[model samples]
Each structure stands twice: as C-alpha cells, then as structure tokens.
Target: MMIYTIRASRPDEWRAQRTLRLEALKDPAGSVAFVNTYETEEAFADEVWQQRAETQSFIAEDEVGERVANVAVLVESGEEFEEPQTHLVGVYVRPEFRGGGLAAELLGAAIEWSWELPEKVGRVRLWVHEDNHRAQAFYTRLGFVRTGRTMPFPLDESRTEYEMVLERP
Candidate 1:
C-alpha cells in the first residue's frame, strides 16, 4: 500500500478533481453511490470548482502528486423550518486505496471542516445505497445512523438510498 496524503482542494486543481472523479465513477460500486457520469464530471466548469474549493472540498493525493480521491461537504441554507445542514457528496477514494482507512479519513476530514464553519453545521448527512452493506458498515463504524429516510436514487431505478447523519459534537 502506498502512503497517501489528504488536503483541502484548491481551485487550480479542478482538472485533477475531474480526473479522480471520473476514475471513481468508473468503479463497479460507484454506479450505485454516484449519479454523475464520467463525461459529466469531466465537463464541470472551472467556476464550479472555484466555488466548491473555496467553500467545501477535499482531495487525497498519491505520493507522486496525483489526485486519487475527492470528497465534498456542502452546506445548504434553510428557509422556514428547513433546518440548515451540511451534505456530503462526491465521496470517492480510488479503488486501489480501499480498505486502507482512506474513506474514514475522508469522512473525518469532512466532519472536521464542517465543525469549523462559523454557522456551525448541526448535522452532516449523506445518502448511501440501500443495498451497499459495505458502505453501510463503514458509515456505521464512523457514527452515522440511519435516519430511516429513503428515496429512489436518481441514477438507478432499481436502487434506493437511505439518508444517514452524524450530529455535530
């Protein structure tokens, strides 16, 4: 296993973000977790990257400086009774890095980032494939509990996702 480093992503690394995202989308398990296709991710504009990096995004890089994972934690402002929250998205660690604690590290980093927001995010949430036991276990180990929230995943008709959340300390 290679020793990898993780950091908050930068606007200039949008291309790297695009590349790693596509690679992650190509993974067999990715089809269930992500809705974006390779081409769609690859085509994201620089403006999108700039806004994301400045506010909420992180990336994992290999020893040689290539991006291998990209995770984003975005906050959605709430209107009446909406209950503002932070959402976890674009979480992908290269297949090669699986089982090396990279996913947990990514989630921890995102959690840490959300805690630093001045508004103080109350909860962090994400949608995970209903049938993905591997992911469910991983998330459970990290303190995410099923909210009993279910919705049809946008990308696949046969799959459903459960909303899970971890509250801020």
Candidate 2:
C-alpha cells in the first residue's frame, strides 16, 4: 500500500469531499450504513460539503492528493438528563483503501478530538447496521462495545441499528 496522509478537512476541498463521500455511499457496505442514495448524493449542494469541512470532518488523502476516505465526528448536544456526547458518523474508506488501517487512524483522530473538550465528554458512540459484521468487528477492535440499544432503520424498519460506545477509560 502507498503512504497516505490524514488531516482535518478544509472548505476548499468540499468538491473532493463530495466525490469521496459519494464513492463511499455507493459502496455495497455503504448502502446500509450511509443514508444517501446515488441520486441524493449527486444532488447535494456545495454548501453542505462546505459545512462538513468547516465542522469536524477528516479525510485521508493518497500520495497523489485524492481524498480516498472520510470520517466525520458530529457533536450532539445532550438533554438535561444526559452528558454531552459525540456521535461518530459518516465513516467510510474507498474500496481500495480498505484493510490498510486507515479507518482506525481516522477513528482515532476523531476520538482524540472529542477527548480534547474542556469538560470531558462522557463517551463516544456510533450506530452500526446490525448486519454489518465487518464494521462491528472493526469497532470492536478499536475497543467499542455494543450497548444493546437498537433502533429501527431510518429507511427500512425491517433492519435495526445497534448503538455502540467507547469509554474514555
């Protein structure tokens, strides 16, 4: 595998971000995990991509400067009863980029950012499609544990998503 660089996303790179995200969303595995379809992905406006860059998005670039993978951490404000939590979403790697440990690197960076908060975040969590054993295995390897909290799929009630969490400890 060729050496690649991982860094925070930049607004100027929104087009590249869109391209990579579309590719990821088109992947077979992405179909279940990602919420976008090919048509919807193609119609996303430039502003959406820009906001993603301005927010907590990270991308892995190849030696030639192509964005091959992306992992974004979106912070969700907690209600009165819950501590502020960080949601890990939009994680994907180019089909060719899989198995190179890029996902781990991207996820590690996201977690590190969450831990940097002045008031520590209670935990980092993500939702994985129940049938996505590959992703479950990857998250497990990264020390995330299943919390047994399940939700119906947004587009398909027949399928369920499992809530998984990784504690700072």
Candidate 3:
C-alpha cells in the first residue's frame, strides 16, 4: 500500500489540481461521478483553477507527490433553501487508492473545514448519482443519510441524483 498525505491545496498549486481533476474526469465512473467533462475543464484558464484552489479544497498526495484524491466544500446560500449549507463536491479518488479509507479521509477534511467557516453552516450535504451504488454506500458508511430529495442529473436528465445530508452536531 502506498503512503498518502492529505492536505489543503494552495492557490498556486492550480496546475496540480487541474491535472488531477482531468484525470478524475477520465475515470470509468467519471460519467456519473462528476458533472464536468475533461474537455470543458481543460479549457479553463490558470486563474480559474487558482480561484478554485483557494476554496475549501483538499487533496491526498502519494509518496511521489501525485494528487491521488480530491474533495471540496462549497457554501451555498439563497432563498431556495432554509439556511446556508456546506456542500461536498468534486469528490474523487484514483482507482488505485479506492477502498483504502482515502475517501473517508477526504470527506473528513471537507467536513472539518465546513465547521470552521465564518458563517454558520447548518449541515453538510452531497449529491450522489442514484445509479452510483458504490458512492452511495461509501457516503452512508460516513454517516450521510438520504434526504429523500433528488434532482435530475445535469449530464443526463433521464438519470437522477439523490441528496444526502450529515447534520451538524
């Protein structure tokens, strides 16, 4: 097993972040795991990635310093929801690192960051593709429960994405 270090991403590490994101978009499960495509993300300017890195983004790097996993917490606020919520997004782990508890580590990083935010975040939520049973099971193991709310998958309207939440304790 390869040793991995999990840490927050620096804004200047946009290149590394972009590379890993593109790699994740190419995964076999990428179709349902992510809403962005390699082509679309590849066209983003360096500054765009830099701004993304500044957000609550965390990455797991291998011994060789390759980013093997990533997750981000996005703060969402509007009249649509009762209170502002922290959303877990862009979660991905390289195939070689799967089933090694890296996913849980990534999520823990995001949740920790969420609790430290200046604004009071009521809960942490994530959307899992209804067809992605592996991801659903993984989230459940991490204490996320289905909210019985779903939205159409942006990439495929015929499919659905279920909303899962972990209430703030």
Highest TM-score: give the candidate number. 3
Residue-by-residue lDDT tens digits, candidate 2, 3-68? 789988887877787888877777888868876677886887887778777767878889998888
lDDT of 1 by residue, 28-74 (tens): 88877787776776677878756656656887888999887778888
lDDT of each: 0.82, 0.84, 0.91
Q: Given candidate 2, what's the lDDT at residue 155?
A: 66
Q: What's each prediction's TM-score? A: 0.89, 0.93, 0.93
Clashes of each: 0, 0, 0
Pairs clashing in candidate 1?
Answer: none
Task: Give the candidate number with the greatest lDDT.
Answer: 3
- Give the winner by TM-score: 1 or 2: 2
lDDT of 3: 0.91
> Can you list the residue pairs that collide in candidate 2?
none
List the lowest-lDDT window of 10 residues for candidate 1: 76-85
Query: How does residue 105 of candidate 1 score in lDDT?
Result: 90
